[model samples]
Target: MNNFYKNYSGIILLLGGIILGSIAGLVFGKDVVALKPIGDIFLNLLFTAVIPLVFFSVASAIAGISKTNKLSRMMGIMVIVFLATVLISAFLTIMAVRLFPIHEQLQALKITEKIEDKPLADQLTQLFTTDEFYQLLSRRSMLAMIIFSVLIGFATLRAREKASGFVRFLNEGNEVFKHVFILIMKLGPIGLGAYFAYQVGVFGPQLFGAYAKSLGLYYGFGIFYFFALFSVYAFVAGGIRGFKRYWANNIIPSATAIGTCSSIANIPANLNAAKKIGVPDYITNVTIPLGATLHKDGSSISSIVKMAVVFALFGRDFNSADAILLALGMTVLVSIVEGGIPNGGYVGELLFISAYGFPPEALPPAMIIGTLVDPLATLLNSTGDTVAAMLVARFSEGKNWMDVKEAA
Candidate 1:
């Protein structure tokens, strides 16, 4: 019972809050719009705090990596595998949204108009870098800030002992912001509750149907990815034997991912499973730990789905080739900086809205979908790391990695 409560408490509170807010809307009708300020206050707090939160967390996540680990063959292969799987998962989700149509098809949003006036090359340049550093300090240029943070991390890596104190500062800052985020989330039950009340009041209940439909698509595809996609990854790593070995040892890790809803939490299980599946310790140690934060097929899917839902809600054309490509790339980045902390998906959602120039109202629904889809998403996310370890081992240790382990 204690474990159950500990694992499920957040979902319960969030759901309870939404339920209460929805009730208030049904009962109070348009008068519930009075609660809009309360919701705004919550959004304001999140937006204000998230800028530093992202900078510090992302910088530190990168800074903590050992320089030796940064230059290895294992790192390169792991990165390729991560990107490949993320692209596959993201494209899958995009296709699913098209075939099923989770929300009512609507016209493109105003942002699409802006996209037409700007040249593609110029827009790409601006997305990656800012004209000035001060611009990165704002959420409007999140991609720039992330790029800068990554550079800082790499720079710190190069500085070695000379930058020890600064490295400590980055790590400490990451911890501080994590706690700060926790404090902010204490208001979630109330804040999100009020926001939902405002949503139901102002937007009508039709949006709820969209939420239900999207959530269903996410869960359905998540399960398929877990069972089918993972099998294929394992098969690539070790052929028929590797496929059998993967299923033999992966159940506990998969279970932990679902139960905890955290990739970080599933690390030990992944490590143990990888060892059993004969991944070299060198490969297991790096991929599982890095994959906890960096490699996330599940979050990739979630990000694509979140982007589509936001587009649909705003009457935007999600099917545009440019939008699809941008969404695919953003999924990879979102998977990179998505902290392994509680409510971390909030940062990713914030990045989505800001990157696309969506108004603040789009945030709540994305966040709610994240909450609803988290369990299965984490399952795909955490287990994929172990599978990635298999791929890395296959590359690093040769095609007969499993046989080599037995022979050794």
Candidate 2:
């Protein structure tokens, strides 16, 4: 009981906070907004720590890569696999949201402060880069900062033996920020509770609005994608036999992913499953571990849904081509920064808040969405790594690579 409580305490507190806040709102009505300042304290702390957290976590994850791992062809193919799967996920989620809008009463719910309607060209420029280095420090520049972090990581990679100290600093910084997040979350019950009260009181039914539909859509898609899409990926990699091999050996990895709900935890299971399913050792060696940190088809799906719900809550049209294009681009960047942080979804959630100029209040709902969808999302995230290894092997070897391996 103590062990279980210790492990699940954060999630328990968070949900308890929301439940208590909802009750308070029901009892007290509009006066609940008075409690909002307390919630704002939590948001402020998260926003302050989040930028540095992302910088160090992302850079450190990439810099930790040892150049001695000479699986260049496999690595290149792995990049293609990661990006392609995430793109597909983002689009599919976008389509799902488009076909079944998360919220119906957009005009009534739109927030007073909105992101300025910039020309597409200007929006693109701002989204991708900033004029000054200091600008990257802001959450509004999260996408730009992510790009910058990736560049710094690659530069460190280029420096090789000379960059060891800098890499160590990044790792230490990441550890520091991780603990900071822990301390901040210690305050989550009070903060999230107070905020939920304000939302329920001020917005009425809007606090509970569309979250049910959104979560339902996510779970449905996750299940369908898990069985149907994975089989397709395996079939593509190795033909009918490849499909058979994947499903045959996938049970343990899938079970571990579902039970643990941590991508990193599922790595050994994925590596073992990949080996059994006939992935070349070199491909599995490079892809599964790295994929735990760098690739995230499931996170990609959740991101778009979370963004769409935020848009709906703020009274924006997420289905617009421009809105969706920007969302997909941000989804890619979020997938990069999101994978490497501890309690990492906070960075990705805040990225949406900052990038879209959503008020700080927008965060809790996104965090809630992340928490709700995490299990199935992790299932995809971990399993996808093994399937990706199979794809990399297919490309790196030949059409009959699995057959060739078996013959030997």
Candidate 3:
């Protein structure tokens, strides 16, 4: 019993948090505002760990790459897999919308918003960073840090003897920071409990009913995407036995993704899951982190569903050939930008309106749909990450790689 409880504690705590929090919120209403500090503290700790972890982990992974050719091969394969998963996901979402049409009135949920326009040149500069060290300090610049860290890793590799100590320091720092992050995660239940409660209190029933048609369609198709699409990816990587093994091994990451609703927060769990599924440490380290930032099948599909809903609300024709192509394109762009942006998926829906030239009135409904499906979006994103890592292992390592000891 103790061992069983230990094994399932995170899931237990998460469910307990959501249930009790929801109850408390419904019972206490606005008074639930008192619980915000508890959730805030936990979220702040998570945000604190994100930048250091991404920097050290990715840099160490890249620096450790012995053959530069292999890095390119791995990246090339990974990008192909990521794009395939996303495009297929978007296609499925479109089919789902066509199969079960959503019809509902958009509630007037008043919310003000703005998206800052950074030109292509500036975006490129920010991605690599003109001042690498300064941009690393900026919490918002994850892409910049990733680019800078990879460059540093390559530099360290070229100057191995001279940079050995620095690389060692980075590896050691990664271990230390990872341990600290785990320590912080020990408080996840308390933090998530309060946070879940606040969410329920603030937007539970009202939001659900307001966007029920779209939310229902999003989740319904989301389930199909998760089980059906993931199974296909697993089967492609490994046959029947391998497919079963992957799913069994994926429990931790799956639960973590659903509970946290943030792929970044789900990385540690994904790492463990990757190892259980027989991906080597080297590949897992690089692929999972990169996947967290890039593999966003969930957001791609959800973006389409949100667009369809917003279009329907405006009596706009979403079935037009131009709209279909626009959604496909926007899905890719949005998935790329979704990482590390605060409330990014919600804000990303604005692009749907802007892309289709919809009236400004469509923004509120888009926000509503996006916010409601955010958790499932994270699940799809993180789930795809774990699968992508396994696929990388299969391509780079071999099929026999995953047939080893099952993931605990």
Task: List the pairs of residues colliding in candidate 2.
Answer: none
Better of 2 and 3 by lDDT: 2
As for candidate 3, its clashing pairs are: none
Model 1: lDDT of residue 173: 89
* TM-score for each predicted model, relative to the true structure: 0.95, 0.94, 0.59
lDDT of 2 by residue, 1-408 (tens): 685555456677788988899899888999887898999899999998888988988888878876654776677788888889889888988878767777555433545565576767887788789999999988788878888888988898889779889988988998898788879888988998898888777778655656787898899888888888888999999999999999999899888776666788889899999988888787788899888887888888889888877887776677778888888877777777775322456667888778877888789888888877877888888899898899888998988989878876
* Per-residue accuracy of model 1 over 80-113 as CA lDDT, tens digit each: 9999999999998998888888765533322222
Residue-wise C-alpha lDDT for candidate 3, range 1-408, written one tens digit per residue? 685465446546655665687688788876887897887787666556656765676677656656557577877778788888889899888988888776435433322344344454554454446464675755455556656777887888888878889889888977787677667656766776676567557655554454677888889888888898899888878778658878998888888776666788889998888777777777888889878876799889888888877666555567877568767867875675455322346434544454444544454455445656777888889878988887887787677766443442
How many clashes in each candidate?
A: 0, 0, 0
Clashes in candidate 3: how many? 0
Which ranges of candidate 3 are over 4 A from the true structure? Answer: 1-67, 103-210, 340-342, 403-408
Name the top lDDT candidate: 1
Provide C-alpha RMSD values for all models, in order: 2.4, 2.0, 8.5
User: lDDT of all the models against the reference?
Assistant: 0.84, 0.81, 0.70
Clashing pairs in 1: none
Using TM-score as the measure, name the better of candidate 1 and candidate 2: 1
